[model samples]
Target: MTGKIVVITGAGGGLGRALSRRLASDGDTVVMLGRTLSKLEEVATGIGERAVPIACEITSPDSVRAAFAQIAETFGQIDALINNAGLFQPSTLLEASDELITDAVMTNLAGTAFCARAAIPLLKRGGHIINVTSESVAIPLPFLTIYQASKAGVENFTQMLNLELYDRGIRVSTVRAGTMVGEGMSAKIEPETMMRMFADAGKRGIDMMARGASSYESTVDAFRLILNSPADLYVPSVAFHGLPAGWTDAG
Candidate 1:
């Protein structure tokens, strides 16, 4: 993966920041795309010369197009794209507001599609696209109907993109991760709130072991695997830690 130009959406924070550092350290030129330029610059500073910050709003096509054009001009070409920008807001099917549902869909599903559309032309043969979705798509949890549906859309979109790009020698893969434990999680909500969400998730038979149990390192390893693998290799649709029944581990 040396010298390969990779574009990571939402590279400013959380999993995206971790992956940006990992890839940049491995000698890949990573373009950090996010809504906030300052945050992206913060991550880019840590990554040094290998990382470039590009402010982008994933939900807006104009924003994606402009960002990719800048990337093409600066880097000449893109070897891979990681559609990692996503939003998760818990909303039950019956109680979900239209705005909440729309926002989730726009960020998680439409955002990935918009980026992929802009990236395909820049990606030559043997390039790859990795969509960072969630395990919740498979094991739907309570109070997250909209979030689940948005990720489910990403999974389906990635599968179809893979088949569509097969003839062109481009591969598409997805990393459906479980609950990733990192600064992002801790920063988003307090411990008590997390406990309540976990308890509610448990009652829905959503498999807590697989739902909220992943370190940033583990998720980055999954990304590295996709990047280093051959074009024909396709990893599973989801990845997460396992907790046995009656197990109690929550902080």
Candidate 2:
């Protein structure tokens, strides 16, 4: 990974932060893009000189284009791009307002597409694009209709984009992640509320594995495999942690 320049959106926190740190530690120059400059700087500082912080709003094409311009100016080329910025809001169909659905689609699906469109020009041949999607797309669990729909859109986009970019030697892949339990995630929810939600979900046989449930290292390893593989090598259509029986069409 040495000397390779990689750009990761939402690189200030969550999985994005982990990938930035890991890639930087592996001697790859990581460009961290996020809406918050301070958060991005914090990640960059922790990663030493191998990381660069760039303020970007993936929902805005101009912001994404400008950020890529800065990256081009600083790094000269981008070898890979990871579209990891996304939002997750669970709402039942009856209670899901237009605002909720719109936000999910705009951020998770549209934002990913925008970033990929902006990065394609700068990405080198044989470079890779990785989109982080949720396993919800497969199960279609209740109360997460919007999130599932948005992620399903991402999956479709990734597949079609791979074909469109095939002639240019770029490859596209996605990580269909399950629950991840970790420190930062717990902070986002009240302990009691989170516990209650989990308990209720369990009663209904709907398990959210929580953040940090899967080691961050495993996700990074998958990223490395996708990036290091030959351009013609095909990764699985979807990579996920767990699934109920008959969830996939093969069953």
- The lDDT leader among the candidates is 1
Give the per-residue lDDT digits (tens) of candidate 2, residues 107-171. Answer: 99999999999889999998889999987787645556788889999999999999999999888
Question: Which has the greatest TM-score?
Answer: 1
**152: Cα error in model 2, Å:** 0.5
- Candidate 2 runs further than 4 Å off: 186-212, 236-238, 242-251
Cα deviation of 233 in candidate 2 (Å)? Answer: 1.8
All predictions: root-mean-square deviation over Cα? Answer: 3.6, 5.2
Global local distance difference test of model 2: 0.80
**Can you give the TM-score per candidate against the true fold?**
0.88, 0.86
Report the number of clashing residue pairs per model. 0, 9
- lDDT score of model 1? 0.82
- The regions of model 1 sitting more than 4 angstroms off are 186-196, 206-212, 232-238, 242-251
Residue clash pairs of candidate 2: 180-210, 180-211, 180-212, 181-210, 181-211, 181-212, 181-213, 182-211, 182-212
